[model samples]
Target: MFRFLPLPEGALCLIAATAFCAEYLLFYFHSTSHKGLEGYYHLILVLLIGLCVVSSVAGALLPTSFPVDLTNGIAITLQGLWFYQTAFSLYGPMMPDGCQLTGDQIACGSAASRVRGELLANFQLFSLVLGVLVAVVVSYGYAASRHGRS
Candidate 1:
């Protein structure tokens, strides 16, 4: 069944990254404003989108090397986690105990809570990386075995 899909691994990664990029762009445009941390998030989102575009081109041009696939996997996972962080931190109940959303910006009541939120974001990124790594490895292994190369 999987044989019907003929895209190379890198191309697959690029497709996923592109999807995330589109979603991020939509969110960025729809948001109230880009100021303070919101601006920072928008900047990061733009950077991530650029990375995805470059990676996608590399993947299409050099499908044999796995570096593009790995990079895209990491970037896409980070983008996903970052989106979650932004959603929760700015608009959801996950806002830290001392933080309040103030007209498209987050105002933390204390530095401690802000630090905690940052720590949690780090942990989320780490967890997403781990999960993406495992999935990539497993998928690569399966593909290789199916092709009878390893």
Candidate 2:
């Protein structure tokens, strides 16, 4: 009954990107205020939504291009990791002690903590890129072997 469980790579990427876009939009609208660096979070969400839109369109239009497919995967993964980082840094348990939520604004008592957060985000992005690369290579190899092409 579930015939499309293994959707084509492009379709899967398109769906994932669309989902992330919807989620980010919802978060943007639900927020009570954007003060100080809070606005930056909203900006990140907007930027990610734009990236997802591009990735979705590219995935749909250039499904056969390995580079396009790889980009889509990387973009989607990055968006997810960024969402996690934003959530934890802004409202979750990972929030540093130097940061406090005042009304709608998150004030960091130490600039170093904020800088550390940014560096952590960079690390998250790098790790996701490596993971996506490995997954893509393995999937491509599997597909090739299954099709008896290599």
Candidate 3:
């Protein structure tokens, strides 16, 4: 990308996807610094970041596919929302009773409690996904109705 000149087609998309690569690596290596519930939540976030990477690449390859573009947007939205949820759970009162935020790390009373917290995080993720799906469908339907199109 010399002087950002004569960039190849989809170069911007690939560049955007590279940012997700960095995020994925950060979360993967973050296990050393983050523990227990915090690490688990970050792991889930990494999965979402991976999705974003895949969708962005797909968008680059299939530039005309509106669905792929929509998917990339949705994945990015989910990643951002998950970040907020992780912060709230790890740094706020939403944290499971057994876990405590100790000096920038989350420590659990026991392994069993940490597992329970992970399970709760799974539930939260599923709920967020379902809610977003519902919202998307409703928005699409409303737009279609108003425009008299499907």
| Model 2 TM-score (2 dp) | 0.60
For model 3, the stretches where C-alpha displacement exceeds 4 angstroms are 1-9, 148-150
Root-mean-square deviation per candidate = 5.6, 5.1, 3.0
What does candidate 1's lDDT look like per residue over 1-150, in tens digits?
458977655566567557756765775675447644445545555656666666766776677776866786567566666677667656887665666788757776776866665665556556666887788789888988899554
Model 2 residue 121 lDDT?
Answer: 52
Error of 2 at 102 (Å): 3.4
Worst 10 residues of 2 by lDDT: 30-39
TM-score (all chains, Cα) for each model? 0.58, 0.60, 0.88
Candidate 3, lDDT over the whole model: 0.87
> Local error of candidate 1 at 106, Å?
1.2
Question: Candidate 2, which segments miss by more than 4 Å at Cα?
Answer: 1-37, 60-66, 145-148
Flag regions of model 1 displaced more than 4 Å.
1-47, 60-63, 142-147
Worst 10 residues of 3 by lDDT: 1-10
Q: After superposition, how far is residue 8 of candidate 2 from its true place, in Å?
A: 17
lDDT of 2 by residue, 1-150 (tens): 239486665676577667867876776775436644455665665666677778777877787887876776677677777777778767877665566777767887777866665565556556766887888789888988899543
- Candidate with top TM-score is 3
Top-lDDT candidate index: 3
